[model samples]
Target: MELITYWISILPELGNGVINTLIMTFLAVSMSAVLAVILAMGRMYGPRIISTLCKWYIEFFRGTPLLAQLFIIYYGLPSWGLNFSSFTSAVLAFGLNSGAYVAEYLRGAVQSIDKGQMTAGLAMGMTKFTAIRKIILPQALRFVIPPWSNDVIYTLKYTSIAFLVGAQELMSKAKIIASFNFRFIDTFVFVAIIYLILVLLLTLFFNWLERKLKIPGFEIKN
Candidate 1:
C-alpha cells in the first residue's frame, strides 16, 4: 500500500523520464540508421580503402561492449579535449555501437542479391553506380527489414545504459526514485514491467510489418 501510494505520487517524475528515454532512443536510432546505410554501402561496393575502413569500424564497435564504449565517451574523451554533455555522450555511444550491427545486417542483405541483377541493369544503359542505386538497393531493403527491426528493438533496450552516464532516462528515474524512497524492489519491478510492455508492443508491430511488407512470390531468404 505504501509503495502504491509512493508510485502514484511519483508518477509524474517517471513520466518525464519516459519522454527523455523516447527522445534518446529515437535520436540514436536515426543517427545509427544513416551511418549504418553509409557503412553498409562502403563495405559492399566502395573502393578498397573505403571497404577497409568500413570493415575496421564494424569490427571495432561490434567487437567491444556497449557499456565500455559509453564509459569511454562520457569519461575518457575529456582527457583528449573532446567533451560532450551526458545525453549527447549516451546517444553518440549507442548510435555508433548500434550502427555497426545494422551495417552488418544491411551488408548481408545487399550481398544476397543476385549478381545478374546488377549486370542486367548495367547492360540496359545504366552506369555501374546507377545500376547499384536503381537496381540493387531497392531489392536489398526488402531483405533487410526484418533484421533492421531487430536492431531497432535492441536500441530501445540499449537506451537504459544512458542513465548510467547520468542522462536521466527511464532507468535513471527509477534509480533516483528507489534511492529516495528506499523501495528498490517496487521501483525496479515497475520499471521492468514498463520495459517488457514496450518490447512486446514493438515485437507485435514488427510482426505486423513483416506480414504487410512480405511479397507473395518473392523469396526473401538469402
Candidate 2:
C-alpha cells in the first residue's frame, strides 16, 4: 500500500521520535501519579494548613493554560538561576499539570465512599490513616479507574507540547521531517497513526485491567 510504503521509507526517523515521546510521556505520567496521590491524601486527611496548600496548588495549576505553565517552567525559571534541560522542563510541566487534574480525580474518588465505612473502620480499632488505607482507598481506587484512564490518555496527548519547548518528542520529530521533506501532511499523518495505535493499545490494556479487578457485583460499563 502507498501508506505502508511511505511509512517504511521514513521509519527510522519516526522511530527515533517515538522513543523520545515515550520517554517524556512515561516520566511525566509516572511522576504526576505519585505526586497526585500525595496531594489527594493531604487534601483528604491532613491538617487544615496542608489541605489548604494542596487546594491552592491544585487551583493554580488547573487554572493556568498548559502552554503558559510550560512557558513558566521552561522560560521563567532561568531568571531565578534555576535551569532545567528541555526534556526536564517538559517532564516537570507535564507532571505538574497532570498532577493537578489527578488530584481532583482522587478527591472525588475519596469523597464518594460512604462515611459509614470510615466509622466502621474506626469502631474496629483502626486509626484514621489505617482506616483510609485499609478500607477507603481500595474501593475508591476502583471507582477512580475510569477517570484515571482518561487522565492517562490526556497525558499521552499532552506530550506533544514538549515540542514547543524544544524537547525532541514525536511532534517535534514530525516537524523536523516535514521541514526537510516538505511533506507536512504526510509526516503528521504518519505520526497521528502511531499515536492512534498507542492509545488503542493503552485502552485495551486498561480494559483488561478493569476486567481483572472487577468487583463481584459491580461492573464498569464502557
Candidate 3:
C-alpha cells in the first residue's frame, strides 16, 4: 500500500523523465532515418569507393557495442576538445548506432524492389541518381516501414543507456527516485511496465502504418 502510494506521489517527477526519454528517442530516430537514407543510397548506387566506405561504416557500427560507442562520444571525445552535453552525446551515439541498422533495413528494401523500376526511370532520361531518389527510394521507404518500426522501438528502449552518461532520462530519473526511498524493485518494475506500454503502443501504430501504406495489388515477398 505504501509502495503504491509512493508511486502515485512520484508520478510527476517520472513524467518529466518520460518526456526527456521521448525527446532523445525522437531526435535519435530522426537522425538515424536521415543517415540511413544517405548510407543506403551510397551502398546501393554510389561509385566503388563510396560503396566500400559505406559498407565499412555499417559493419563497424553493427559489429561493435552501443555502450562503448556512447562512452566514446560522451567521455572520450572530451579529451579531444570535442565535448558535448550528456543529452547531445546520448542522442549522437544512439543515432549513429541505429543509423547502421536502419541503413541495412533500407538496403534490403531497395533490393527487394524490381530492377526494372530503375531501368524504366533511366529510359525516361532520368539520371541514375535522380531515378533512385524519385523512383526507387519512395517505394523502398514504404516497404521498409515494418522493420524500421522495430528499430524505433529499439531506440526507445535504448534511451535507458543514456542514464550512464548522466542524462536525466527515464532510467536516470528512476534511479534518483529509488535512491531516495531505496525502493529499487518497485521503481524498476514500474519503469519496465512503462516501457512495455510504450512498446505496445508503437507496435500498434506501426501495424496500422504498414497496412495503410501497403499496396493493394502488389506485395513484396519477405
Candidate 4:
C-alpha cells in the first residue's frame, strides 16, 4: 500500500528520534535519582540550615510548572551568561523537576521505617550518619523502588517536552514528518502508539523488579 511505503520511508528518522528520546530519558532519570538521594538525606538528617535549604529547593521545583522550568533553562539562562544546548537544557530541566518529586517519595519511604531501627544502630556505637548510611538507606532504597518505577515511567513520557526546546525527540520527528507529508493523523497516532508501548514495557519491567526485590514478610509501617 502507498501508506505502508510512506510509513517505511519515515521510520528511519523517527527511529533516530526514539534513540535521542531514550538517551534523554536515561540521563534525566539518572540525574534525578542522584539528586533525589542527596535532597532526601539533607531534608531528613541534616542540621537546621541544610534541612531548610533542601526543603525550599524541593518546594520550589514542585510548585512550579515543568514547562516553565524548561523555558527558563533553555531560554532564560542565556541572560546569566550560562548556555546549554537544547538537549542539555531539557535533561537538566527534567532532572531537577523530577528530583523534587523523587526526593519526597524517598523521604516518605525513610519515614515509614521504625524509629527504633535508628536507635538500635546508635546503640551499636555507630554515628548517626553512619547508621543511616549503613543500615537505614538499604531498606529505604528497596522500599522506594515501587514509587521510583512510576517516576521513571513519568520521566520517559515527559521526554516529549524536550521537543518544545528544539530537541529532536520522538515527538519532534513525528511533527516534522507530519508537516512534510500533511499526514498529521498517521504521524501522531504512530508516535502515540510508540509512547504507549514504551510505557507498557517499563511497567512490566518494574513489576518484575519489584517481585524480585520484595522482602519476605516485610511490611512498611503505616
Candidate 5:
C-alpha cells in the first residue's frame, strides 16, 4: 500500500511521461511503416542496384543494437553540425531502425503473395506499378497484418530506450521518481504495469482489426 501510495503521488508526472512515450512510439512507428512499405516495394521490384541498397540498409539496421543506433544518431551527428533535439533524434533513430525491420516483414509478405496475381494484372493491360498498387499490395498488406502487429508492439516497447537519449519517456520518468524516492523496485514495478497495460491495449486493438479485416476466402485456419 505504501508503494502504491508513492506511485500515486507521482501520477501527474508519470502521466505526462506516458503521453510522451505514446507520441514517440506512434510517430516513430507510423513513419517507419511508411518508409518500410516503400523500401519493401523497391526491394521486391526495383532494379538490382536499388534492391542491393535496400538489402544493405535492412541488414545494417537490423544487425546493430538499437541503443547503439540511438547513441550514434544522438551523439554522433553533432560533429557534423546536425545537432538535433533529443526528441527529434529519438524519433529519427527509432523510425529508421524500426523501418528496416518492417521492411523485412513487408518484403516477406509481398513475396508470399501469389505470383499469378501479378501476371493476371499484367494480362489485363495494367502497368507493373499499377498492378502492384492495385492488386499485389492489397493482398500482401493483408498477409502482413499479424506480423506487423508484433512489430508495432515491439516498437512501443523499444520506445523505452528514448529515456537513455533524454527523451523523458515513461521509463525515464520512472527513473526520476525512483531517484527522488529511493525506491527503485516500487517505481519500476509501476512502470512495468503501465507498459503492460499499453501493450495489452495495443494487442487487443490488433486482434479486433484482424477480425474486422479478415477475408472470408483467405482466413487463416486455426
Candidate 6:
C-alpha cells in the first residue's frame, strides 16, 4: 500500500517525464528523416561531391558513440559561441546521430529496386528527380518502414541519455524519485516495465504495418 501510494503521488511527475521522452523521440525521429533521405539519396544517386560529403557525414556519426556526440553538442559547442537548450541539444544530437543509421537502411532499400525502373521512368518522359520522387521513393518507403520502425525504437531508448545533460526525461525522473525512496530496484523495475510496454506496442504497430504494406513477392526481411 505504501508503494501504491508512492507511485500514485509521483504519477504526475512520471507522466511528464514520459511526455518529454515522447516529444524528444518524435522530434528526433522527424528531423532524422530529412537527413536520412538526403544522405541516402546523395550517396546513392548524387554527384561525386555530394556523395562524398554524405559518406563522410555518415561515417563520422556512425563511427562515434552517440553520448560522445551529445556531449560535444551540449558541452563542446558553448566554447564556440553557440548555445542550445538542453532539450534542443538532445533533439539535434540524437536526430543527427540517428540519421546516420537511418541513411544506411534507406540506402539499402533504394538500392534493392531494379535500376531498370529508373530507366523506364526516364524513357517515359520523367526527369530523374521526378522519376525518383514518383517511382523509386514510394517503393523504397515500403521497404524502409520495418527497419525505420526499429530505428524509432532505438531513438526512444536513446532519449534516456537526455537526462545526463539535465533534460528531465523518464530515466532522470526515475532517478530522482528513487533517490528519495532509496528504492532503486523498484524504481528501475517500474521504468523498465514502462519501456517494455512502449516497445511492445511499437513492435505490434510495425508488424501490422509490414503486413499491410508488404508487396506480394517483394517482402522485405528487415
**Candidate 5 residue lDDT tens string, 1-222:** 876788789889999999999999999989999999988987888899999999889999999999999999999989988898899999999899989988898888778777899999999999999999999888888888888899889989999998898888898989988998898998888899999999999999999999999998996444
Error (Å) of candidate 6 at residue 12 is 2.3
Off by over 4 Å in 2: 1-3, 219-222
Q: What's the lDDT for all of these models?
A: 0.90, 0.88, 0.93, 0.92, 0.90, 0.92
**Model 2: per-residue lDDT, tens digit, 117-213?**
9999999999998998999988888888888888888888988988898988888888988899898898788888999998998899999988889
Model 4 residue 119 lDDT?
Answer: 97
Question: Pairs clashing in candidate 6?
Answer: none
Q: Rank the candidates by TM-score, best first.
A: 5, 3, 4, 2, 6, 1
The worst-scoring run of ten residues by lDDT in candidate 5 lies at: 213-222
Instruction: Kindly indicate the candidate among 3 and 5 with the higher lDDT.
Output: 3
TM-score of each: 0.94, 0.95, 0.96, 0.96, 0.97, 0.95
Candidate 1 residue pairs in backbone clash: none
Leading candidate by lDDT: 3
Q: Is candidate 1 or candidate 5 better by TM-score?
A: 5
Poorest stretch of ten by lDDT in candidate 4: 213-222
Q: Model 1, residue 163: what's the lDDT?
A: 84
lDDT of 4 by residue, 1-222 (tens): 877787788889999999999999999999999999999999998899999999999999999999999999999999999999999999999999999999999999999888999999999999999999998999999899988999999989989989998998999999988999899998887788889999999999999988888888874544
lDDT of 1 by residue, 104-221 (tens): 9988888888889988998999998898788888788788888888898899998998888899899999999999989899898888888898889889998998888887887675
- State the lDDT at 120 in candidate 6: 99
Q: TM-score of predicted model 5?
A: 0.97
Pairs of colliding residues, candidate 4: none
Question: Where in model 6 is the C-alpha error above 4 Å?
Answer: 1-5
Q: Identify the superior model by lDDT, candidate 2 or candidate 5.
A: 5
Candidate 3 minimal-lDDT segment of 10 residues: 213-222
